[model samples]
Target: MPKPSSTKKVKTIPVPKSIRIDLTGHQYGRLTVLGFAGYRESAPMWKCQCDCGTVADYYRCNLRSGTSTQCVQCRHADLGVRSTTHGQWGSPEYRAWEKVRQSDNVCKRWQSYENFRKDVGPKPSKDHQLSRKVTTSAWKPSNVHWVHRDNVVQQKSNSHLIRFRGRTQTLTAWAREVDLSPAALRSRLESGWTVREALTTEALH
Candidate 1:
């Protein structure tokens, strides 16, 4: 008699449970939900009409969490009006101020563009950005300064930089210094390789 052949059992993946929330005809801030737009990244999306008479698709979570309200046109309109009133609209200074304000990271006093200008004065160049001297602290006149974009980028990149071989540098910087691609170095790190091994390993052609 022929010996019985072994059969391998396959595991079935369970279907993900969907949590549905109906938001049709509901008003959230300046947005009125019209109907479902479809799914995005596995999350439900809704079609909404803004008070400005524009229709856009928004994530259901953003609508319910109050993250997004009006359309982009309305936001730009408000920024333009407020910035023009301060005589700094369309200027680099105004753009920097608007960036901070939109993030809701500004101090109450800075809410007024005039007050913000009075404190920060003006941007030295188009490449200058508003930066907080103490990042952990709130955005206040005394804690903020205008810094060159390059310096800001360096500071941010350096914050989470790694050190190897008694030399400290960002992953990109180290990769460039060693003639290795940054993406490859990152991939090695992600694959549980030690930092020293990741940086020193030769790329396979």
Candidate 2:
């Protein structure tokens, strides 16, 4: 009763009417969104539990975009593997395997160096390198080879590199996936069509 007599009704600020996407219970790589962590500036943040059991806050966009897949400790741990030379961890041969591996060109059956070597054979010399026969096609015995670095063909100036679903490919490769003309897709992209719209919408002509 005493408080009610003295206190006056003051205007209160309302929470901003922003589009909030609830990512609770969603897992993005090693980080799983546990709950909200308020806002960083105007952007929302999420409280995530890493695979290593570290709980921390990260930006919503980063988690949603697949940019931040793991905690810092886990990333550092990964470098430990990269620091080795047993598998020639950072060597060109390893990189060649990694490149195709990440792009889903090679399957899990070819994961180990032994299997890769069995299929790919030993490198003839230091100058020899692995090359993909078809940029878009999956990597297999018939689709890959070893060639001298100097003998590699230079890509053309007009060749465009576009990324889709975490894999970067030449515009020509993407064209194979679309039923419409590659020119039409290129035109759509050039005309500011979103990736989804350009890839999905069929042309009348």
Candidate 3:
């Protein structure tokens, strides 16, 4: 039998372990990281609580990249959509809310979709719009309602401009803003009444 040739022995080097990032008690937008959740696809995830008190898990990349700032409800609230409770993200109501949610006319309380939905209720029909009784007034429960587009009042031109509450608009616009009657507002403007006076004066209603 032929003698076997001697072979050299090879040694393997140990790889260094990855350092895990500790994110406990870190706040990102409306979320506060509670602890490490687990790993997903070899990536780390974290458990977080939203400002609204909802808890959920998110990937570290999403939080660090600013992609997952808030929990589902709060995020959807900011987007004028619902989580699993209502309709889809791009629904008509979502589109309508998108147009006005950023405006100063929207009440700060409405920032929470829960409050908005509770006060305004659901959209009656696709033809309806979110409207305020006083066109220029901020959106609130008492003044807000769903009105059909066709039946809504036609806005007049900005011919007669009046400045109120650090903002300027036409008489028609001001009429919808404050509770003051249009006739009274026009009289006030024509009589050289200050915006504060017009907004603070007793209502004719």
Candidate 4:
């Protein structure tokens, strides 16, 4: 019988000091030898083992020479997928967003929304925790009038609450009590009137 040939030891390449392996998705640190085909010194690519048991190319220049230690799949797991759609432009949810985008009065706010979509991504919901009143449902064309933030304070102050006070009073009725026409009160508030001016009964007269 022929004697068994002695097995040659395979050379293990040293991982670079700067190299960082994305191990979030991987359960083990050891690389699967099957996926990474034996070293090809001539080519610029190497087959890398994936946690999913799939083989992928890990550029030698990227792995040993640079910072890449794992396949593209591992990299994607670290960074969430980025969306290409604008916040309101392509969304089917905000159907009336197109009209606001074209209107002159609302164009400024719409432009801001568009810019935000370009930078981050679509967010149909309000994210500012400081202001609890802002909501996606309230950010409509008619509701969102272009006035200074201070004017928003003025409107909030003058706004009538017609709870069950014997009989609910219409805004026109409340204006009558304050001795001012509904149109006049609305104009004062819309024109960025001071909070004190909106609250005082003298403005009504």
Error of 3 at 92 (Å): 2.7
Counting only residues 3 or more apart in sequence or on different chains, how many pairs clash (N, Cα, C under 3 Å) in candidate 3?
Answer: 5
TM-score of 1: 0.54
- Which stretches of candidate 3 lie above 4 Å from their native place? 1-88, 155-205
Error of 2 at 31 (Å): 3.3
> Which sequence of candidate numbers ranks them by lDDT, best first?
1, 3, 2, 4
Error of 1 at 109 (Å): 1.6
TM-score of every model?
Answer: 0.54, 0.42, 0.37, 0.23
What's the CA error at residue 32 for candidate 1, in Å? 2.4
- lDDT tens readout by residue for model 3, 1-205: 1112421122212211332467777888877777767543334567777776666877665676565677777655655534455554676665666555644356778766567777777789988888666654566788777878876645223335566667887776777777656776665533333456556644522
Residue lDDT tens for model 4, 123-191: 334421111122112233444433435555555445544322356554466557767676665444333
Point out the higher-scoring one by TM-score: 2 or 4: 2
> Candidate 2 lDDT, tens digit per residue, 106-166?
6456666546667887677898777666544456777778878776545321445666778
RMSD of each: 16.3, 13.1, 20.9, 24.8
